[model samples]
Target: MVLYADPRRLRVSAVAEEVANGCAELAKTFRGPGAFARGDQLVRASLSIVSNIAEACGRGTVPDFRRFLLHARGSTQEVLAQLRLVKPTTEEDRRLVRSLQSRTVLVLKMLNRLYGHPPPDR
Candidate 1:
């Protein structure tokens, strides 16, 4: 069966890709061991959002897609929560976190829309 109509054309896929890249950038800011470990967790959560979206699109059924979208939405929230826990030591770090936050929110909105839910208040 066909997976996605064309995953590349999906807005959620684009946003998820951006979120994963942003997580990689954010992960580079850590110095000590503990912070680095937390950064790793954040990166994993961020990438999970992307993977779940791709899996959703590949399911070839609306119900399956919505189930996976819920998982992606949860992952998006996880990334945002991780971002909130980070203490950015520089202006650049602060800006990066803000950008990631914005992108994650966009992904959340897209998933919500796809799942037939009302837009969430940001």
Candidate 2:
């Protein structure tokens, strides 16, 4: 539980949370007649991104952290795919999805950089 010394530590989690909030906004916006039933998975997956990153930071070893980072990246990709399938019924939905899509892409890129070349355990 000692990974947040750096001021930049909030990068990934912040973006992940943004994605989650975006999903929630979508769900709330479309609340009724299933409340965007397909979004259930989307929301959960976005949340996974945040949780995995947090889990990674809490791990006792670098390898475990890296592994959870990979999981976060996978969840990021899932969010992207779900965003693609989101049938926005309003301009607000379209805007939200577009914003979420870009942010999700950024988070994926961030995760890729974070764990793609982590230093070897030494």
Candidate 3:
């Protein structure tokens, strides 16, 4: 359980959730041909990151948690790749995409750190 409000858990979960929401929002903009598939993939991968983290929290062992974190890390990287493929037209879209990309990267880093150095209680 997250008894003490662990900052690592907070950052990983909160930021990953934000990334998922942002990716979902971004996906709606891709109504054009060829873009729909990419957007769908983006949403799936982004959502995976959050899902993995949540799964990690419910695990009984540190290794299990770290394993799920690694899964989340992979999903985060996929989101980054999808974000790279996005070619935003307007400044507003560009800002939104960039913000999502940056936040996704942050979540990846947080996942890596948490995986490498888990909490004392596991």
Candidate 4:
């Protein structure tokens, strides 16, 4: 039997979804007056990664796709930087942020590989 996987379930999509969910989860932990604004920025950047990847995949040519993937990779890095500004008091919160960071790195690596570019040195 031939099994077909949903195109939306591609590796980039899955990673983007995970990043979105992680941002949402992190936003829920904010409580102060300025929290909402900061959280919104984080959410927007995280969601951009998802949309950019989808757009890249739909583009007609390899170069176009690579350009958008680079944008998506930049957004991933942006989200990671935003996440660092949040002070997670609990172990659970710390773990969640760490997980998101790890996933972002993985996605960046995947995008670089797809574009035939070497992963950036840390």
User: How does each model score on TM-score?
Assistant: 0.88, 0.83, 0.89, 0.84
Model 3: residues >4 Å from true position, as ranges? 1-9
> Quick one: ranking by TM-score, best first?
3, 1, 4, 2
Give the C-alpha miss distance for residue 40 in model 1, angstroms. 1.1
Write one digit per residue (lDDT tens) for candidate 1, span 1-122: 33343457778889899889989988988877697789899999988988887787677766677788899999999999998988889999999989989988999998888788421222
Candidate 2: misplaced stretches above 4 Å?
A: 1-8, 31-36, 117-122
- Candidate achieving higher lDDT, 2 or 4: 2
> Which is superior by lDDT, 1 or 4?
1
Writing each residue's lDDT as its tens digit, candidate 4 over 19-68 gives 89889989989878899998999999999988887877666666666788
Model 1 residue runs over 4 Å out of place are 1-4, 117-122
Instruction: Compute the lDDT of residue 42 as modeled in candidate 3.
Output: 99
TM-score: model 1 vs. ground truth: 0.88
Which lDDT values do the candidates have, in the order given? Answer: 0.83, 0.80, 0.83, 0.79
lDDT of 2 by residue, 53-114 (tens): 88887676667878889999999999999889778888978999999999999999888887
**What's the lDDT for candidate 3?**
0.83
- Residue 51's C-alpha lDDT in candidate 4? 89
What is the per-residue lDDT of model 3 for residues 1-122, given as tens digits with 9 covering 90 to 100? 43122434567899888889989998888767888799899999998998888888777777777888888899999999999999898898899999998998888788878877786672
Write out the backbone clash pairs for model 2.
none
